[model samples]
Target chain A: MAAEVVASTVEIAAASQVGMKALGAGLAVGLTGIGAGVAEMGIGSAAVGATAENKDLFGLVLILTVIPETIVIFGLVVALVLWFV
Target chain B: MLAPEKMSRLLIVASKDQLAPITGALYRSRLFHIEDFVVEGREGYDGFSIGKPLAGASEASGGLIKVRSLENVFAIRPDDIDPAGARKRHDDLARVVDRELAKIGTEVEGLTSRRSKLEASIKEYEQRIHEITPFADIPVDLSLYRGYERFAVIAGFVTKNVAIREPAESRIVKGKSSNFIVAVVPNEDRADVESELAGAGFVASPIPAESGMPHALIDDYQAKITQAKAEIASIEMNLDAIRQKHADFLVACEEVLKSEVEQAEAPLRFATTDQTFVAEGWVPSSRIAGITDEIMKASGNRAYVAELPIGPHDVVPVEYNNPSFAKPSQFFMNIYARPKYTEIDPTLMLSIIFPIFFGLILGDIGYGLILLALCFALRKYFRGEDAEYFLKVIRNASISSIFFGVLNSEFLGFAMPWWPPYSFSRHLISEHGGHGPMIPELLLLAIWIGILHITLGRVLGMVNHYRQDHGEHRMKAVLANAGWLFVMWGVLVIIWSGIVMPLMPDLTGFPMLVAIPGLPMDIPGINVTMVLGGIMILAGVIFIARDSILEVVELPSIISHVLSYARLVAVGLSSVAIAMVVNFISIGMLIEPQLENFTLIGAVVILAGVVVFILGHALNTALGILGGGLHSIRLNYVEFFTKFYKGGGLKYNPFGLKRRFTED
Candidate 1:
């Protein structure tokens, strides 16, 4: 009975470890997306404001808004790194 | 630093006597007043000075003349000769000249009328020639071949022949064809004609008819039209010069006659009235004393002067001032200042808060340094009115970024040496778990910021209300806003503590309250306390709703306003989540031992990773800035302003001299 209990405990510890690794990976990916979204929120608003002020700024606004998307790309890299590691 | 000062006094004056001198001085100084008054009774003076001499003259001779108004005498002194005469003598001479010119003018009018008739006749003949030219000639070339012989036939005839068929009758030939012989040939059914032609056994191949007169007539008409058109063009070119000379002569005669009439009547009596000569103008404050002295000298000490405070009208005129006169910095301030009179100056507020917010969101020392460098560089490059505004914004943002970077314990992505050299050092340090300093702390800070911002907005709203004649309403807004803030803070604090820990226990058998199994959970005591705290918040919300609804007796409307602050959490959460993602991506990529040593591969990976990270964060920063800024403004304008602002005041504008283009 003692042996069985010890084996079960070991199995549970290993499972928890695997779960943590998975959770970390998930967090990395999820955080990246969130970051990207947050960055875009500000950029998008600014772009729209600029475009509203001057119709000629359509291209410039678009470029500026995309600049914030880098956050998401970074997030993606982290997610990939975590998965590979 | 010296306190800034503004221009204080301005005066502008317009008068008939000083018009010439003042205009000349203004032109030389490149300063003038914009006059917008409509002349109410100009017709009374139409004939009064109809022939008056050009102002600023000494004598009259030949083309020189004199004009006398009721108040002043003027003579046109031509460069070539002196115009010398008493006002009355000049006036008599002018009358005689006018009488002679009038007689000559009549004759000229008759000549002009005759010339017009001649021009019309010439045009008609030109048009007739053009019409006759195209169809003038019909020529025929025929080749006839018998079995053993060949002959060529050529003929020319007029296509359009104009003839006097009778003594008074004329016929214009419409069509003449070179193929007339062929057309006149009879068919076989005309047996007599066919038999007569066949009797000779001569199979006749008749050549077409031709004419020469139509061609000649067309050419003749074309030449005539061209000549006429040339003559008309030359005459039209000279017409303007002729008219100008005539006009000048008439004006000279009229001026002479008017001078004579003025002398004959009252010897140019100067009309006097006690009109004080009130005028207003704008001058650089530095030059105010000089301008006042000059004005007094010119007015003969008959003007009153005073200074007015710099109001909206004093600073920026409403009419006749170019829109571009507003400096970019002033314009930016005006964006938040002038639109709603009751609102706080957003320029001042933005100058304070935007940098702090940016630093909080971005929070990396290395990144902050980069931003500072970039901002400074951009400031140097873009140095103008607009650039000044940008520089101010960037200067503030860079300071905030640096401050946040220190607080967040990040230099680049690397942990500072003072802290544990690990990404989760703070979390690890607090693992003994009593009140942890970690992600949760960061989130709490964001919430605290929101609370402060909302509170400030409410305070501003109340102030605005009080200023706009709603003292009672302002008091209510203040109370309601305070009540909610206190309730939210109190509840949040209770939930943060573990007072109710004993009510529920976790799987570890520890005392807990309100713990949920199989889900991420905080301590039970904190959870239960949060529930209680939530009730307090709810109560405060109800009270705020009641106050707003009661003021307008519209209960439903208050719900929308209360819910609006929810965006505060939404935006904050978005920023935090984005940061976490960036950190994750930066750490996620595997660095194999063998590949790590390969400089090229490592460099490539690092470059790609850095690029992605920077781009992602930049995007997030931009988005957060814009979203937070706009929503922040929206909250102020709608939820807050609705509580107080009354913004329909007309902007005051004053007329002032402005140059559209500058030569120097």
Candidate 2:
């Protein structure tokens, strides 16, 4: 009876481990997405204002606006690593 | 080659009489970048003032305007036509062009005015025909409707049908949108008739003054319109013939006049006195000798040319002297900010690295080929000043994508035929139809890239500081750059031994984490790499603080910048996922099910599936371009460039014209 109880407990622990891993991956992506959005809000508004003034600044403005988006990439990698790697 | 082309300041002092030949020489050589003299300035100019335009500046400018107007009407651009054979002398060309201009002007202007008048008359006739058509069904003539004595006539279309009381005879013609109505009543009961009609929501349509059958009038107007149109066509034909006959002449005249205007106006930028003229400008250092010799020969030894010493912070107009292939990459540097005169130009490095990053992120054979075709197709459309530069950069990037795509074994997010079925870890794609579990390894690879890229920037920073800085400050600037490098490598070593080895080790044969024997090896829990890493970090921190204590606060930025390269892998994987999802939805969810139960409706469904497939991939491709291009360059600008670059260079715009049609 003792041996059967120990094996059953091991099976329960394994199931919970998967659930925890999924939760961790979800958090990683969600929080990073929020962080990236916060970073971009300030830059996006400033870029639009600058572009409005000088039409030729369109190329430079585009690069500035997308810089924060790379932060989300970091989050995505972390999430993928948690789930798959 | 790594820096901007060397610029030497050129100052010229010539007798007032020699201005013509010297100006001509400068204009023809196209080597001078003039610094305009400020006429109103109260500086140390002494008696010198801005020189008057050489001689025929006003006359040349007026001729230019006339030639350009003719050129514009004829739609002739400098680049559109080649220089005609046997160039004419200026006086002859001007006389000929002016005579032709007068003849063409009178003929073309008269024809145009006549055509416009005919068009206006046609519009009026057409309007009359439309107004009369509404009254077509009414048999009453125009005279009978208008000349009513001792009777009131209300004629218009009405919305709702209304009954009229006694004294008015109502004639109604019903039509599609509204009904045409005419009421004739005694003059005494006119108000009553008007009130009744107004209650039914009446609208008025004026009858034409001419008395004729509606059909007859329409036929007459139509004949007139047809004649007018024929005349207009003849006018167009005449104009086109004129354009064809004199197109080459107009182009030649315009080129000569433009050059004349440029050369005549050259003295506006020169400082002058009553007796002599002085000009100052920058020329390429190597070309200065050649230009001086030419100017001396042209002026018959009357002009004196001297090279002035450039100050430390003097404004130097930078012209890049990159190799032919690397020329296109200067577009990116120009966009961000051109490098300073004394600074190291990172354009070549950007040219080589940015494409690799783009390819790595958008690595798929299908996307690569599509982009290649797109770049080729778009090459013709973007003919602005920098179109070739943009197209070449994109083409290089597309080729890189193909190379990286083959290594990734991904053909539009699906496993390629060469993708190893047994060895799942070898390729970036999985046989099971999704991204592989090698994402961590890719991320690590990106980190390594970051490390090397940042290291190069830091080293360049050292070189820039050594070159630009004066004395003691130079040593400090270089040491500060060295400190950053130390911190970057030390952090990488620490992470490699402490984190990468223990947590993510996919490749067994990869080179890293080789523990060498050292004094710190005896420590129970610590290794030599970690000990060395700690010492380096400490030394780096001290060196950095020595330059500016506040700079130590930015130390973590180096570590974060390294982590920023993780985006290279993360972004690519996201693109792959999108492509795969699109493929799965269109082929599996849409097409495959319809094929299983093929029917008449199934054909439509399959068509929809194909459209969905194409549209979805199109969306993915656009995103791939934006993500791959912007993010890849952003890494260079924000991470790599910040370490070294301080760009505020002006472009070298020489005073003379780069003649496309006429040569001096």
Candidate 3:
């Protein structure tokens, strides 16, 4: 009976470990998204001001604002790899 | 289709008396890109100086300054008011407008000065009030606080409660408004009393220069402050009334005065002798006749227009003359640099390729429709120089996306039954019986596109080289471009045979390459076709190296440029993947299982799915636009433009009126 309790406890801990890994993956993507948001706040505002002045800057400014987004993509890729593992 | 219009130089000489008519004619014709008249000695040229402005220039400039000041005062832009209405009002005030403007200008100046003085007086009164407020409870005349030989007064603020120690004969009084105390002590113990006050964190306040009691002086200053504030408010009201009456008039007057000043000052660009003024400029070859006709007609033939024979070295201004459909692409070209008159204008090329690249990455019918709707909405709501070109590009891109979306059979993330699948749409629809990884197919398609695009550039460059007067450099360019084209084809063939063939084992019987058989000549893991491709590439490298040894380093860049097309695959794949994840979260997990029963909980789940769907699609659409638009533009600008474009031509900037409040 003592052996059975120990085995059940070990199984529960193992399941929780997988759950923790899933949580870590979620945190990675979420934190990176928040980071991208913070970066875009300043760039997006400046881009809006610039586009307001000259509409020709729309394409260039869009490119600049989206550059920080590559960070989130990297994070998402990392999260996917981790989840798969 | 690519080259800018040919330009011809014009030298017009007219009498100084005819300067007015000539300037008027030039302004009206609007075809002359007038070059700045530099006074320099040349063959058949004599002493000349820059022409002075017309007689009315001073008055016009003064009026412009005044109207601009009025604009600043009112904080109103010309576009804020109705131009047609302002023009009518301007006409109504034409006879009396100048007098009214002067009167209002002086009145505003006087009011502004008075308002500033009142503000300064108010500040002074407030300071006096502050000085007196702390001692309001002292109940002694301000004069009594000072000029006392036997008693010493130390009035200030202290954070802690005051305590009279021995040898400090003191009377401390605290005020109601703040922790400010007024203390009196014997003259002998004044320093001791101040030290006691200092120990309790006391800051001294200066005595006011008044004779009345502290409270009475404070009240008097408050009354004066209120009176001054009232005067300022009245002055502001007067200014506001002036703004209300004259904002539109000011904007119109400003526009008119500015035009007058510009016209009067136009002679500054002309080279003048004692009696004759000579104007030299370039006009489009096509418009040369039209401009001559207009100048003669407008100036009554007083100005003699002569076409100067332009030499090869003449710096001609470039003007793009494309159809309205392709005209918008000039925005992109202009921002990069105007194409030289000798080189091809790449506007039409950009118009064709930019949309294809944008569409390929964002190929989804649902998203395309959304973008199409947005384009329509933007067009309906906004109208400006900025909106016009952006909308033009977006409209083409949206249409192309719709077309590619139909080809790909995608709506949002889901596929339609009738259309071929994403990977199969571009390749053999029948042979690949099952779906394979689309990334490889997309990458291959992207590389093929790169090859074709770069080849077109090289061909255009070669044609440009041949079209020019042949020199050693021109011959080298022709050979190098031809060799690079050969290398590109070799690389394409190698990629087709080596990599694409291995992917599909079932396919067979394509074009066979000549295998160069040798003894003991083997590199580990190198393919036979690649080795053949290397030899073919060396042929181009040899030609390039003959001209510039350093240029051979750029050979690897050719492969990198082709590989850069992988962005097209990566961006599109990311968009599709995100959309699928969104669909799964919204529909697959939430609504799929309980969707059949339609209970209250199921209804809630469906509602949640709907919300998720909207938010998810919104995010995806934004990302799609950024990625699709920029990556496509990057491929055109970084890859294609670097191949052949050498853009540093002067844009043709003709003198013309920016008519805002007036029709003529």
Candidate 4:
């Protein structure tokens, strides 16, 4: 009976720990995604206008459009670290 | 591989009459990139006005315009005529071009005019039919509606039937979607009746001056419309036949005339006088001898070719001088900018490094083999397109992925059949007979890669500064490059020795260099690595501040940029995670449980699992490619190129026509 009580308490602590890590991971990705979106908004519009003027700018514009996405990838790495490590 | 091809400025001077032969020789040599001769209005250039085109430039230009117009009329494109197709020989091209152009132009004009006439008649018949269509329901003579002096007829479709409180006769026909009403009122009540009808949303259409029964007239007009359409189709067929018969001759004519016009107008770019002419251009040093010989032979020793000394400040055109294997990466370099002649071309380095980064991210046996197959398949369809170069880069990357996949022991997202040697899987542990949750090790690996890549960039920056700057400035510039490296490494060492090692003992820190492989060198023992870190940071800050004070603000970027390479591990992990999740859902949860039953529902479950597996893996594959390719290129362009490369060199364009459908 004593051993069962200890095991139950340990399980509760583990559950809360996992839950907190999950929350932290969620915030990391969500906030960074928002940041990346804000960054891309201005660049994406300007890239479109430039591409309209010169179609050859399409490749450069595409690269520029995706550069901010790297920030989101960084966030993902952080989230993985929080969850796994 | 690093430097652009060397060029020498060449000057050609000749008597006015030898200009044509010299120009012709230059065109045929195809090695000279002409520098336009500006009229400076001083000294030797005072009498040297822009050269006029030789004899037949105008005539050739006019013929070219006609041929181009004929091409437009027939909608003929370069793709329509195969370059290798055996063309009919025209012994006298000028006569043949003129004769064919005249005959085809007249024929097309005649056919087009007839078609337009038919189309116009068809429109007229349609308009007459539209006016009579609404009136057809009313049994009235159309001439009686128009030629009345004392009576006015108001006839149109309406929303609802109006109570015409006038000495009037009215008929209402209700259609499916709307109501059609026609009314005729006395002249006195015409205004009143019209207002009442207008209140019901009545719109009046004018009657046509045709004296005939309604539906019969409509059928006659419809028949005429059908016949006119057939005539237009026949005319279009005749035009297509003409296109098929004359496509080769016409395209060839356009090519020959285009070449002639360009040759004739070439002199406009040269400086000339009544007695003499001068032309200046750059020729690749390797081809200078052959070109000079050709020019001399063509001019029959009449023109003088002089090799001019090229100054440091001259804008020499740059052609990349990479090995054949590295040539395809020029696709990326050109999208950014071609390197200047004075700077190193980064194509060779990019070709070597980019695929390795790609492999590190997309390393999976199943996906790698699939991508390799996909690249070859795409190459077949995209032949002769710019995309072919990009596809070649992806193919190389796929091979690298296969190599890394073997090392990682990943097949799809599952562990290899035997115990895998290495793993970066997020939750799997070796004790559980699974691969890994080796996050710390992979993160450390990413950091080391970042350090190596960034350091190489700084070292290249030093070399560039050494080549580009002058005297004292060169020293300072090169020192600044070194300073960035020193600061970055110093901060890294401090973090490792003072903070990280004491906290987590699992990460075996990067090895510091000692004297020899077998020798363990002793150091001044009070945490020597940390002390060295402090000293290096101090020295680096001083050196960087010597160049520009604000550059110190950018020092943090060295660390942040290093951390960014963590995406290599992160993106790959995400791809692996997706594949694992898909397999678990489709196979473990859906198919495996039902496989024992062997019932109809079991069969359905297996089919659904297969669909989910295919779709999910396909999605992951697409994501893998996009993430791997973009992140690798981003590191090169944003992080690496920022160190040493600044590309604004002029492209090497020689004055010669690239023909598509003409013979020499």
Across B1-664, the per-residue lDDT of candidate 4 in tens digits comes to 7889998999999998997888878886778898888888434677788899988899889999999998998898866556767654433565578777889999998998999999999999999999888777777766667777778777787887667764698878777766777777778888788888888888776767888777788989999999999999999999999998988888889877877787788888898888888898888899989999999999898888989998777899999898988888998898878898889899999999999999899888889999999998997667454587889899999998887787777777876654545545533434347546677778878878888898989999999889988988899989998999889888877666544532233222434433223322322123557667878998898889998889999887887788888888888888888988898999999899998778998999999999999999999999999988988988888778888888888998887766666555
Worst 10 residues of 2 chain B by lDDT: B502-511
Ranking by DockQ: 4, 2, 3, 1
Tell me how far the alpha carbon of residue B240 in candidate 3 is from the true structure, in angstroms, after superposition.
5.2
For candidate 3, what is the lDDT? 0.76
Give one digit per residue, the lDDT tens place, for model 3 in B1-664.
6778888999999889888877877776777888888778544557888999998899879888888887787687776565555344334544565787899889989999899899999999888887787778767788877787788777777878877765444455655644777666778888877787788888888877789888778888889988998899998999999898887667767766776677789889888989999988999888888989887877788789999998787778889978778887777776666788888788999999999998898988889999999998888666565577888888899899888888777778777565456443432122335553344455567767877888888888787777763778888878888777767766765554444332333111344445334523231234556566677777888877776788788876777677667667657767877887888899888878668787998888998998998899999999999889888887777677777877788889887666676545
Tens digits of per-residue lDDT, candidate 2, B13-110, equal 99999999999888878889998887776466789988888788887788778778767766777665656676656567755766776677777778
Model 1 lDDT per residue over B1-664, tens place: 0011223445444344543333333333433232222234533222232112233233333223322210011122222122222222333444465355546445545545555765787677666554434333333221221111222221122332222211121112243451111212223334443343344332333332223354565466567666766765665545444444444344444445433232222212212123212233444456567655655565565455555454443332221122222223233333433434334433445445555655655555666676677667776566445576655566556667667657656554445554542222222223233332343334334445655665566566556645544546666666665555556555544545533222222233333456554443434433544555567666666667656755334333333344444444344335545655665575456233425576877777766777777786787666655654454444444544444333332243322222111111
Which of the numbered candidates is closest to the native, going by highest lDDT? 4
TM-score for candidate 3? 0.78
RMSD of each: 18.1, 5.2, 7.2, 4.6
Q: List the residue pairs that clash in candidate 3.
A: B2-B345
Off by over 4 Å in 2: A1-49, B40-44, B74-95, B129-134, B147-166, B169-210, B244-248, B381-385, B414-429, B432-435, B469-483, B500-556, B582-616
lDDT tens digits, residue span A1-85, model 2: 9999999999999999989989988888888889989988998999899989986576577667877776687677778888777
Number of backbone collisions per candidate? 52, 0, 1, 0
Provide the lowest-lDDT 10-residue window in model 3 chain B: B500-509
